[model samples]
Target: MNISIHSFTLKLRDPFRISYESRNEQEALVIQLSDTNQQGQTVTGLGESTANNYYQVSIERMQKEVALVRERIEEYSLANEVLNAGQVGTPGHLWQQLQPELQHSSFTLCAIDVAAHDLYGKKVGQPLYKLWGLNPADAPTTNYTLGIDSIEVMIRKMQAKPWPIYKIKLGTPEDLAIVRELRKHTNAVFRVDANCAWGVDETIENAQELKKLGVEFIEQPLKADNWDGMKEVYQHSALPLIADESCIVEDDVAKCAGHFHGINIKLTKCGGITPARRMIREAQRHNMKVMIGCMTESTIGISAIAHLSPLLNYVDMDGALLLAEDIATGVTITTDGVHFPDENGTGVQLLTPSPTSLV
Candidate 1:
């Protein structure tokens, strides 16, 4: 594994606020795993994990973790090991091989895993979705996120980009007012994400009102750890609930089965696309709605999610759309839907040269 970590900052076009914090920019990290393919062409896989204040995952911490595993990673590249695409266990094998070290941060592991998937796809000369035997036509249209802001600003955001669906962030005394006001503008399908801000009673009440206003679902309304509250809300809430903060890993998929109407799998949070594929299958087995969301990352990360979209009921890969600028080129997501690049391996390429690549 010739691990090359590129660090950058992704600036948001608007200052995005959720329940936990507000930010104008996100610190981003891109992981590229390079190895020679059978044709003697140097191929690299791409993955991204951004700094998150809520999760306390910073670029420095991820870098340190990467440093710890550099030797083992390079050893694989030195052996010229060819990563096989279409095998679900490819990333799992990597996780086990890295062992005690890669476990330090899911963020670091996410970058490496994503890169490995991309590398594998490139090796086999196939896009990931095609390799997985998925049809792009089955993929759902992703919702554009309107982060928490003053009602006026939020409305402007909606006007700027009219989408088929909008995921509104809410965590305020005027939560209803915000949605009510935004609802007046467009007939777009609404999905509210409370970011674990409301209590059980508040969530139930809000769901009733939101359902009336055409809200398709409510996401993470109560705190993540409030399983008891979730149970009550699950029983009584008018709108279907989707778990975000509550569902972090494959195990959480089972836990969220009865509690939430669905589960939202985030690659960055769950250690990238490898486990995410398993999580999606598990959620499907549970008959729960499956969704995959992206952190405020670049096309590299969002494209990773895009390839897996055929398996999801809903998708929130709008993270790259929220950015003022992206660090790379990969997928194109417009109001029409996500369009994959013709290139294989997530189809990602950095705009600038990597001066910080570590051998």
Candidate 2:
């Protein structure tokens, strides 16, 4: 068993603006795992923030982690064991044991899961969705995002696209005006993402105002750590609230269960697919809706989530739509919704490595 990593920069097709910031490119770590038996797999892991935010693991640091994990794989013969195990424990229990090794190494854990799924899917000659018992024919329609911009620019952008669903970014009082203007241009179902910009009181006020704009929901309005405040806002506001940052980890779901009407599950934030599935199940049991989302990643990551979108209430897997030039190939995005590959594995095709710069 062996593991290796390469750092790549993905240039966005257009500058992506959010409530927090904007970016022209994204830095990502591509981890490749292989065994002596000729089986090889790859997973692209994105850092927390975009290129300008400095939230990424330094290239040097990432390389070192890859080396360490590669050594561990060899020492434990993990590749052989993972491949040969007739029936592994439930994804949750196996993930629990791997969590210690994964602590402080989110990128590695993400890579490991991707690799494991790729290997497993290949071994069984099935696509990832089938392995998880998900049927692509049941996927829900996905929403495309309209990043923070002047009202005029937003209106123009909306007028040019035929997408039936759109998510607007809002973080300031000025955003109220933008939302109003957007409502006039398109009757598409709308969602607002505050990105934790508002406090409990402000969220309540803004959500009230947004309700008149025909919003379908408001996402992450209050701070992630302020569960009580989120509850206050959720209870007071007429519009539904979806938890984003607040539901990054499994336990975070429990904290926001009673407060949020739904959750935005991102593979990157939750570590990987294993925990993400658990979060979705838990949210379902609590009667909370699910919105599977993604960071600013290539089709590789978005395609991974597209396989599970059918099982959720909402879908926001539009990160690939924002990329300037993606590695290209995987999921297909139409104005109606995202379409997955009919082939085995994730249906993702790894392109020749092309590295860009964050600076």
Candidate 3:
């Protein structure tokens, strides 16, 4: 077994902004794991992780963490030990073994977990979604994002694309105004994300106006840990609240029952598909809506998450769609939603030199 890490940079199609920060470009890491057989056949699995400064994991830091894990893999192999993937085992077991060593960096763990799933699926000659017996018809239409900008700019950006659902980024002084203006342009269903901008009272006030403007849901109205504030808004607001920063993993799913109507699961946030699936089930068990979101990543990451879209109620996995350039091929976005290729595993292929020959 062998693991290779490659760092890549992605430029955004437009300046991406949330409530707290903005960026023109993003740097991410791709991890590829493979094994050689007696016939010299090498099969590879690919995964990606975005180095989001908002998460306090910079590209440099993410690179270092992946290198550290790769070093550990080398050590284990030198001792002739059978690691989880070496024996066609589950990602959960590999996660448990690496959790202690990785210091619970969900981003790092996600890369490995996704790569393992990709490899396992390829070995079994099926995509991960098929392996899990998921139905693609169950997938909801993904929302195209309209980040915070001037009214004219926002309108222009919105007009540039055609989508059935649009997720608008709020947190500006003109939050409601932005929605009201955009509302005149398209009758498409809307989802608003505040990115932890408003106070409890303000959130409730904004929700009322947003509902009138035809918004479907409001995401992370207050600060992540502001449970009391969230509950206050949840009780008063007209719109359903979706937890973003507040819901990190499966453990946080049950806690969202009182404060939020739903939880947004990001692969990196929950440590890849293994825990992400668990998080989805946990959220459903608590009777809450489940959404799969993403950082601005490439097709490698978004494609990995797409495999699980069949199990989700909402999807915000347009990270790769927002990129100016993507070095891989995987999911395709349409008015209906994201569509995967017919290839096996995660159904993703790199456009560069290829992950299989990275060694």
Give the top-scoring candidate (lDDT). Answer: 1
Greater lDDT among 1 and 2 belongs to 1
Q: Please tell me which model should have the higher TM-score, number 1 or number 2.
A: 1
What's the true lDDT of residue 352 in model 1?
Answer: 84
Instruction: Output candidate 3 Cα RMSD.
Output: 3.4
Off by over 4 Å in 2: 35-59, 74-86, 89-97, 356-359
TM-score for each predicted model, relative to the true structure: 0.95, 0.87, 0.93
Model number with the top TM-score: 1
Candidate 3 colliding pairs: none
Give lDDT tens digits, candidate 1, residues 132-232.
Answer: 88998888999999999999999999999999999999999999999999999999999999999999899988899999999999999988999988999
lDDT of 3 by residue, 316-337 (tens): 9888889898889987878876
After superposing candidate 1 on the true structure, give the runs of residues whose Cα lies further than 4 Å from its correct spot. Answer: 77-89, 354-359
Residue clash pairs of candidate 2: 12-324, 13-323, 13-324
Cand. 3 Cα-lDDT: 0.82
Candidate 2 per-residue lDDT, tens place, 1-359, comes to 34555566788766668877887788766555443322544322222211224235555655565565555543432222323322443223434556676666655565556555554454455676876777787788888888887778888777876688999888866888898888887788999999988888888888788888889999998877887787678779989999997887788777777899989987765666777788898998899999888777677777777877878999888877877677747778888566776665566666775464222
Off by over 4 Å in 3: 37-40, 71-88, 354-359
lDDT of each: 0.86, 0.70, 0.82
- Model 3, residue 336: C-alpha shift (Å): 2.8
